[model samples]
Target: MDCNYIRGADLSHDSELNQKALAYHADPKPGKIAIRITKPFMTQSDLSLAYSPGVAAPCLEIRKNPDDVYRYTSKGNLVAVISNGTAVLGLGNLGALASKPVMEGKAILFKKFSDLDAYDIEVDETDIERFCDTVAAIAPTFGGINLEDIKAPECFEIERRLVERLDIPVMHDDQHGTAVISLAGIMNGCHITGRSMENLKVVIIGAGAAAISCARIYRFMGVKEIYMSDSKGLIHAGRNDLNPQKREFAASEGMTQKEAFENADVVVGLSAPGSFSLEEIALMAPNPIIFTLANPVPELFPEEVRAVRADAIIATGRSDYPNQVNNVLGFPFIFRGAMDVRAKTINMEMKVAASRALAALTQCEIPPYLEELYGTKLEFGKEYIIPKPFDKRLIVEVSASVAEAAVKSGVARIETFDLEAYRHTLAERLA
Candidate 1:
């Protein structure tokens, strides 16, 4: 196949997809989501109950107990999708107003995937203290907070401050969402390739927010020897220009991209397209786990990887591929589980549980209904190490695991938890 022909076809397809997306968001109103009244409002009696005299009853009760706010209102099921627009998906520093569409899109996914209610809140403040203050002031309105599209370094500080100040589940989806989903796929890849987590050598091809988070999660999963790279080169302790976040993942030794890939068990590409060459990838161990998760264009294409090493387990951020370690597979279910338990925070335990749950799910018997949805037979293998985003069992398995983890970790406010019973409820949400 001619490379130019493929590039031309991809360009035309992208143009058509973008046009359709614009039309879809425009015709149905100027947004991808909207509020819907869930209660009766036709009669004067209903109006009174919805507000004024009758509403004061629940308000008074909530004021007395404080915790009764969850019982009286929708706070326990509501999440705020927040952003300052500095890192709007591939389009950087577009400002708050421009990130509304992406934020709204996040809210809708929460509703569609997990039966949670969400609102998009775009903060105009860029200063770290001001941004955190604004979000904390409005934090009471939601059971959880999803920080999105804010640039790194600032994002780290904002999330840290807000997490300490608020008593709800808080997550920066760009970091932890990518972490959980990719970790799940990598876990399965390790299982199938006869590799153990502790012994594996990892070369992460970016040192940005997502890349840093991925390194942390890999560490939690018992992976040592994680070598990360930034714009300059491999992140080693000798480098003087490293950010605080990048410095955390610094290796004791420096190596070329080629030397780093030599016998490496896994390589995660979260940087820009062509960040590393295919020749470097060919230096990896047999049956290497290759996750090139850069959106729109990966650091290395699946085809390009396959041409070099046929034993490699491949995944990309794109849905058109077999193993897509996409964030949509993580956030909704994670928040669903956390909010259900009234978790005070989305701790690393919950995140690790969610990723392990996803890995276990991939090896489960694929239901006929699920296979029918994608028009294919699904199985656990190198090609299908990650569960498809459309798999319905995610709500049950992943959510239950997250909730259980929250309870066990002592972050959940709920008095008691029944794992099986909770799984049943999650399944009912889908039904």
Candidate 2:
């Protein structure tokens, strides 16, 4: 694949590319994923074992000890990519049926990137309590639940209740996936810019799920002062209409977006396109780290940022650009590790471990084949603040770190863990 052609391919007005994308989805198969039997079903004995008296033995074993389900069935390796379709990528609330493509795409990523089986499940309910109840009721079938594209306020509550109600690891990927991947970039960007987290003044635009989650995670990483804003303007202490989730990130006083950007050490954008101008980018402090990570488009294009402030280290959510803060780099492997150890939940320690693992991978020597494939040199600098999504080392490194953290944090059900053997197991699964 030619990098320039990929970067320059404009699908918005290109009828040919649009048709190709549609045909790619519609042809050969109706969807991007399908189920295949892992065990033999060709003989009479195979049928007996798969569906009849022989299967009853394992069922009885699972009844005697529920943990035996992991030993006798595929439940341990399966994940449910559940979504209410309230917030489908950059498209916004396209409804359950319309969100199928993105959900299926997510399932494909789980299989392709992490060698895990995922089923895309779109639940057609908007009421928060009903949604949470529905997911919790069905949670026992899978090792983990990946909540996707549920809208804010409700998403926060849904995730909280699900995490508390169910023992299996549950995560709202739209919220924490962006946070984890962006935090990795921030870690390396801060390193390159010679700034410490505690001293940095951060500005986050868009107080939706991703924005609020990023603010919280950055604070956990020792960032003290953070300014955030939504479409209604700055989230501040004086705002009477703020929800509890938004209130957690409210600034001291309401400030205009321009005021929020002034002298900031880092600025993160999760809002709409053209939300920030070059003038806003120029207002940041020297050697600023800017992550304008809106999909399809960003707050400010990389070219616009570079033309205004050459000293800034910029990233976006587009693969064509350098430092793409993609969630694909986080969730698949995060869940892989969580399921590998039968983790009770994805805790703060596991999340931080994954982030640090990603940051560390970026600093390692890039493989020559990866450079040739991506048509760029991969070194730790302004352009390479995080690992590429295609880097095969991700499943081995990030997943192992997360699994180790799960064990150390007392969240793993397994009594013993071998880190070296686990890495080889992860590699062989991909192979």
Q: Model 2, range 1-431, lDDT digits (tens) per residue?
A: 00101123233634776689799999988888888989999999999999987999999999999999999998998999999888777656778888899899999999999988999999999999999889988888899999998878788989999999999999999899999999999999989988888998999988889888899899999999998888778888888988887888887775677898899999999887766778888899999999998766677788888999999899999887899999999999999999999999999899999999999999999989799899977789998998999999999999999999999999999978999999999999877
What local lDDT does model 1 show for residue 68?
94
Cα miss at 298, model 2 (Å)? 1.6
Choose the strongest candidate by lDDT.
Answer: 2
Q: What stretches of model 2 exceed 4 Å from their correct place?
A: 1-17
lDDT of 1 by residue, 311-404 (tens): 8899998888899988888999999999999999999999999999999999999989888888877989988899888789999999999999
* Candidate lDDT values, in order: 0.88, 0.88
* Predicted structure 2, TM vs. truth: 0.95
Q: How much is 334 displaced in model 2, in angstroms?
A: 0.8
* Count of residue pairs whose backbone atoms collide, per candidate: 0, 0
Q: Which portions of model 1 miss their true places by more than 4 Å?
A: 1-13
